[model samples]
Target: MDTVLTTRHLTKDFGRLRAVDDLSFEVKRGQVFGLLGPNGSGKTTTLGMLMGVVNPTVGEFSWFGEIPNHHVRKKIGAVLEHPIFYPYLTGQKNLELNAMIKQCPEENIPGVLELVELADRRNDKYKTYSLGMKQRLAIASALLNEPTVLILDEPTNGLDPMGIAEIRELIKKIAANGKTIILASHLLDEVQKVCSHFAILKKGRLVHVGPVDDVGKGAETVEVKADLPDFTEVLMQFPGTASILPENGVFLVTLREDFHSKDLNAFLIERGVVANHLVTKRKSLEKVFLEILSEPR
Candidate 1:
């Protein structure tokens, strides 16, 4: 696949603090890539550097295989943190300003508004719009130039559940149309649902990077439930146990590593135990996020 964005040992420092340290990753064309981490994990700083809003202290990065510069930036659209607009201006007027700055055709204003589901509210002043509406308008402004890549920082923040869903669906639709998307968000579930690839950051450093599926590939836990009354005894026999949680009259066991279900079942049978339920649990993005965050920096 073609590379849309590439970072090589990118670093940024401020006084005694390192905001982004030695971060390196690649975003493929037509792929939805997520930059995930908790608050103060440098997600926004990375995006700012990528968009040229904040200059890197060291290392380098490129867009479309070329060094990121004003010329290259034209091919990228971005929303860093909150969407900034003139509160007194109408949505249409705000987009018109963006179009002017981007040198795009004025006709693009309505098209982008409609694309973000803000066409009906185009004439409304920016201050009158809800948080969700403001977010969609920010997205519309980003789309004004029809850039090949769209970068968003916490795009769903402060929105209600329904608003988050709307933005998620909109992002999916944007990706479906063959544009690459770079999403910076702490919402692990949202990233899992919307992104195909992701990188986990911690304390200004990149700790994990890969396809979303592979990030948590071996993190799944096995759930075992038996008719035996001594569930604690069964757990004691298993070595390398990570955790055990009881739910719905069953014990959910999280193992340190992968294990065969057949072997587990056989062990229970040999102990004169009859298992009514035995299954491997799927690892969620939330699990992966937490694990990454818990790792020592």
Candidate 2:
């Protein structure tokens, strides 16, 4: 399927509070999609509705262009929160039990274990496994069915640096293998690092949606410092120079629409004004997110 999932004006309400408001987006096949929002922004609630655990108060959604139901859910594997397993059971034993419950073949066990890099520790007790290993085991359980799409809600939540790194690499590995992934995270850096496309939600409302690489496009400000005596005058005369301000002996130039840092540099050179320093400062995802949230809805 070209489209893995689609939500149409999906919304949820708990009494008077709207958990998710008019949410609509599409996840394409083979794309690592990220649902980004802060705590209490209805990310978990949205996932719950999509997974059939919580019913939506308004709107609808579909999986593979079919109505979502148990059968459709079977094609999608997910880990919504912390994973649970028998602490006393060995990793191998836990997966074996999971496979039995999932009705998947026992032969799928070894391959999933190897995929998560937990093969060597398969014999270790679940309680003895480190947090990262436990998380990986949880992901392995989700993958036991060989699902078409995998949904992870804060897969790296509460993880230390090492544990987060482990999950990060594992996610990249999974996405590389042609699985459509829907990842919900509050960590901006992680989303920027792994998600090919993303939707930003604030106060349960989708504020922005686009490819991750397009985050700071057309929003960059260039900082220029020239050795010439008329540096400020030269900068102001350049085409597309929207505004220029002196900051600590450097000029911060905001470019107009359709203008960029390269154009500015070329203009300076043509005018016989050589710059000693020029740096284009792109807005980070975090900065862009805050700006999005602060805008009027």
Candidate 3:
């Protein structure tokens, strides 16, 4: 796959604070790349610089191998922070204005509105639309130019569960059409479901970046649940094991790489402990994110 976006040691500072420090990553064409982190962890700042809304204090980045100039930025569509629109303007009118500004054909307005499922509501004033409707309209404005790369920051914010689901499905459909997507969000489950690749940021630093599956590989700890009160004492005998915590009458054991699920159950049975429920924890992107964020900066 060809690289759609690339940044080398990208750094952004706000006065004495480093908003983004030495951030380096690549986003490929036709892939959904997730930029994940907690609030104030520089996810938004990095995206701002990428969109050319804010300049980096240090390092460099490129979109489609070209510097972030007007000529190149035209091919990229972005919705940064929140969807901003004139409150009195109708959705269709707002899109018309956006089309004029982007130099896109006026014929593309209705099609973009339809893509976002807001064609029926296009005549409604922006202030009268719900949060989800506003968000979808914002997306429609971004799609006016038929950009190859779509960058969204917290796209699902302020939407109800059903609204979120609608946006999620829309994004999946958009990806299926071969458009590259760059999503910066704190919603871990959304990222896990939609992104093929991800990068974790914390304290303005890039702590982890790789394929989504590899983020938490080999970290499948197991949870043993039994009526036995001496589970802690029994778990202590397992060598090469990390800490074990007791929760709701179950023992959640974090094992080292040397141990497996079979080894854990066998060791327990060998000691005459009846295991009621023994299941390996499925590692998720959220777990990997927390693990990285909890580490020292």
Could you say which candidate leads in TM-score? Answer: 2
- Candidate 1: segments with Cα more than 4 A from true spot: 230-248, 254-279
In the predicted model 2, the residue pairs found to clash are none
lDDT by residue for model 1 (1-297), tens: 999888999999998999899998989899899998889989999999988989899999988888678878777889999999999999999888888888889988878887888889899999999888999899999989999999999999999999898899989989999999999998889999999999999988999988987855674567887766787687768664678888888787777665555666777788777888888777888987887778776
The superposed Cα distance between candidate 1 and the true structure at residue 163, in angstroms, equals: 0.4
Per-model TM-score versus the true fold: 0.87, 0.89, 0.86
Residue-wise lDDT of candidate 3 within 176-277, one digit each (tens)? 989999999999999999998998888788898888877657755888886777768778888846879878877789998878889988887888887889
Q: lDDT for every model?
A: 0.87, 0.90, 0.88
Give Cα distance to truth, residue 134, candidate 2, Å.
Answer: 1.7
The 10 consecutive residues of candidate 3 with the worst lDDT sum are: 213-222
Which one is best on lDDT?
Answer: 2
Model 3, which residues run further than 4 Å from truth?
A: 226-244, 256-259, 262-275
Model 2 steric clash total: 0
Superpose all Cα atoms of candidate 2 onto the true structure and report the RMSD in Å to 1 decimal. Answer: 2.3
Shift in Å, residue 133, candidate 1: 0.8
Off by over 4 Å in 2: 228-230, 245-249
Pairs clashing within candidate 3: none
Ranking by TM-score: 2, 1, 3
